[model samples]
Target: MAFGDASFLSRVRGFLIPIGLALLPCAIAPAFGAAALPEEVTVVAKGSGLFNIELETTVYRPEGPGPFPIVVINHGKAPGNPRFQGRYRPAIAARFFLARGYAVVVPMRQGFSKSSGSYIVGGCNVEGNGREQANDVVAALDWATAQPWADKSRILVVGQSHGGWTTLAFGTRGYPGVKGLVDFAGGLRQENCTSWQQGLISGAGNYGAQTTVPSLWFYGDNDSYWPTPTWKSMFEQYVAGGAKARMVAFGSFASDSHTMFGSPAGAPIWQPQVQAFLQEIGLPYEPQPAFAQYAADPAPVASGFAAIDETDRLPDASPAALEGYRVFLSHQNPRAFAFSAKGGWGSGWGRGDTRARALENCTKKAPEGACQLYAVDDEVVWAVKP
Candidate 1:
């Protein structure tokens, strides 16, 4: 729920420090652990002719030995201006893949961040821009296959926005070891450009013509960048060009559909499609406990109570707790305090079909001890210190 003015509750809340938690002087965690967090790494790739480029990469590895299947995620270009650079972190998507026992590698391509080179794309020629960026994605794939922990025979490329366009471009190359592609709102979109829409269609069709690998493309009906008709036309051209592809168009989401991939709330909407694609392609497709614990089907609401009335931080508030919370919030039938506790405790927020069911759901989430309701909607039912 929209807390609006009362959002300040976040500042006053006390943070729970797990026992043995030690503060680190560094700002971020180091990379590559089964239980440890994803690590930041530098991968040097050979781009074009003999030029070696450095990529800032984040890697999330599942808990295991030997090689794991790899899912390479490509980040999108910022809207309005390509020069408005942002940090690349695909932790949410990485978690999704990690849960499926796949190691996820997200690279900040050349020209972005400290990665070597410049971010040069066709000034107005969107197709040329995509082809250039796809080269970088392929370079990442090349580097991934060479790693000891990555399964060379099974590689998947996925991206959003510009990255999505680049992903389809990578598809056109028919890279041998890479099996599939998933594009979320993929396209190079510049609203003011004279032939922007046609450019995207032409670019997608060109890529589709050469793409041999199967692909899945998704778009929200209310995407701000490329509207429904535009993306639909591009998809038509892509498929008409003989690319084996499937398209799924979802209804409008919380905000602009373009930003869905950036939020945990969007997982329920896209994860299933991805899972089915993996299964169809003969890749491992079991849901991991790590992911299932956080999925909420019907979605949850956080309104009704004062922001202070929320005894524990909601799942959406905590990145560490987002997956479980998203699932917890999406329960089909509503429940009150499906789970809650005072003294800095929280679960997915929901008003269950019945009070008993709410309590049961909460207790089930935390079987370790008694489950209590701190609030139903916005009213405080039980009081506890932060």
Candidate 2:
């Protein structure tokens, strides 16, 4: 599914709802230690043809700067929602970058929030979405670079989901000062999704495989919409095309879903990875130990599955149930695997359980294996394996 597709939104909603439930109460607390709230602003500019354009932005700056490295974080589809934009989106990850002394800008795009202009679903191309959103991002970069507080040379563009594709589009086409690119669940290949194809058609390969900038791509193994095979192929193609690209896939959908980066689950996983990538690319920034702590800590299981008891062996479970359990086990840590019923079963069976179960049963099912009953929520995910 394309990032802009209706199905993508459904997946995003599925991922974000759980995160929102988990983190909404803690929103008031300091999500990151020593991280300060960003200063918000609305900048107005004149677009082509006397169109009044308003760009909503949140800027974070570290103390004492001789032009700090600037990272621009573009928002995903639900830009009008403040909860997702400034409070819950990739901008939150930008905070980690800011805490490390990089200047981070989260733009609301053209049509979302207080930003002016028509809404364009796929804006990578010149004519679609607001062509101005891309240009405005570049303009924001220009404004930042010119600032006495900003560094002109080191600039990074990071996007999540829709923004991920935007990062490739803008960075590959050559944003003036973009030193590096980070795509969190961003689709780089047109073949990866219809939205990417739409973008390719709209932008005319503006950010194609020819990009030479060093980039880091992240995705979730269980992202139902964009399967693992498609994501891996996209990265391989980019690497083959000479783009300095590296990809890391997380075990499950917790940090792999479309909206994962902005979630509480995502903050700890991605913040440090991005920071290290920035540092490696020569971006100026002070390192923070908090991200290290975050990395050291294991993420909590997403709340959707029933707790399983390991004392029991494979029960009268169905072939589908056993396979689901195994797939979940394959993704767990060795220590977690030792826990069997709890760890091996995974956090919970997501909407993809049906498909996952089918794949598992097809791959591993013995005529004699006891079909254990696997309870997921109120329903039996599958009846196999203890």
Candidate 3:
């Protein structure tokens, strides 16, 4: 589901090299998670009611010449324009799957970020929208399977939120080589649609009836988008239709449980579940340490400084602060640059509001004055004492 009714919604080499200078965040992946980036691939897909369009995709593989198993990770919708959704990179998922020797393929379906075509909303038909979204998935896999690095016989589809919905819908196809499906907080909840939840449930039942493969579903009580009853009913409706599925309600997580699959902290929560499920489906589950180079770097330590942008504040700064400021502007949006009186400074980059992350990192140095936001996203808010 795209974010907020309107929307919501990588590494390199022989597949490692960057696709273009424009596709990256200043050519550096955020250090908050994994410093390693992914190579971008364009998958030609028919979507947005158009004939043929290109879908932006990211591919990460272990260091080797032989073919490896494939895992296609789907992304949810982001608010506002889908064109600005940027590339989909779940750092944690990329690392976890890579450690297990599965070459990860994260695709930006038609109409997302730099991908071609517009996103198809499909009116109030949640299921129909999912089916439409699944079309792009088919195109991506068609391309991925043809690649020399891909082990076409072993494939796994995993998604979160709207991407999760797409995974479930894709399962109904019984596509060749796809062994299993994993959905984290799947489905679309449109505020404008009356009884859309039931629509989703009914659609899930329809998919369940047609689905020949097994799937694993994850939901949490603290999700701002999905309530327990709403998703539980969707699961019940699905299994009632004969789809072999297991629903894991992980209860509450951090501030919002919906963001689990993407966060590095979430690895412990979903990894074990996924590990067992992969084994049950006759897939590889043990971690392959050789793939560790593909893993994501550690996230910045949480310092509870999330709201710094709202509060105009600053700490002492040295002459070096100016250089850090330049570095801050080069990264992706939704970022923040923080400075400390103790000459400690850091920039938080990646998705979501990282103002606090920046402040927290700066705070660790025990700045002389209160650490303050020097810049946020694209704007610099620091007050230079003349």
Candidate 4:
């Protein structure tokens, strides 16, 4: 996520200038989007009609349309240049809602990925930053709800990390057809900014005070971004603001729980809770059989070349490469470490094809040699048997 220390982990947003609150209807133009995406957002300008931005969006739908219920899924801001961040969506959550007959809309707001615009961080005013981003979300929703295949009456808004903050901020304004809100590890952290945690707490209070929609929030104890105490305090502040909400403190998952929202393995942790929430809110909760076939790709099973800790047995590896392996072992599963006989080594983990990433990185170090996968998850993957 954007607020944490930069790491080998990869996680991944467009621009709007604001002068007012009057939002013109944003035109959804899937026909004019990038060849790969086939989706675009056209000038949903808010404020003084001063500026316009085209947003890239992705929509996932189930077969057979006819006014399907819809969910708006928001994405977090990643570190570095936002222009490089790929098309992002919480695929796991999208599939969950899709299986239950909800069409999912993911929008790349402002300067993220292929969207044209600059990301406005607004300095240390994180709450304001989120509120600003919510404007783009408003535009996305305006277009999404108007779709022929969408049932605007049944809408759910969900966000993770910075998007979580945006979801709550967006809730402050009661837009049309917003039934409920869900936040996963929400907040923006600026280590360089003073009292940023307090800023988030206050921001939650600000959103809660103006929000009438009931909400569900999920924060884990092991989240690297926001700690348990801070989130718990934020929850108390929101409730104290007289907003009705429920907080689920799901202890931990993976290496960092912040990533749980996007990982398919995280389903068992949040799905049941989400299902109950949907039922309570009078939305569709039953899973559809036809969509069941669209399940998430499972992680590769381990191949026992050697116990993962057997770095000493790593064939032809140099002392430096062996040390790197020790560090790689600390990361959670769904990870891979690549190395070559020439001692070129690299590792990768997180929400992408870590094996490929690892090998690609390792290859750069082994220019004259070939890099291969040596370890994956908790097992060694040396292609040749010892």
Candidate 2 local lDDT, 251-339, one digit each (tens): 57443366456453456677767766666665754555533322112223423233444323443254644665566544422112111
Number of clashing residue pairs, candidate 2: 17
Task: Estimate TM-scores for all models.
Answer: 0.69, 0.58, 0.74, 0.72
Per-residue CA lDDT of candidate 4, range 263-321, in tens? 54566788888898787666898887866644443444456767888766786567778
TM-score of 2: 0.58
The sequence of per-residue lDDT tens digits that candidate 1 reaches over residues 306-350 is: 352332655224553354444444542222443344212344322
Q: Which candidate order results from sorting by lDDT in descending order?
A: 4, 3, 1, 2
After TM-score superposition, what is the CA distance of residue 76 in candidate 1 from its true location, in Å? 0.7
- Winner on lDDT between 3 and 4 is 4
C-alpha displacement of 211 in model 4, angstroms? 0.9
lDDT (C-alpha, whole model) for all candidates: 0.64, 0.51, 0.72, 0.73
**Candidate order (TM-score):** 3, 4, 1, 2
| Model 3 root-mean-square deviation | 10.3
Q: Give the C-alpha lDDT of model 3.
A: 0.72
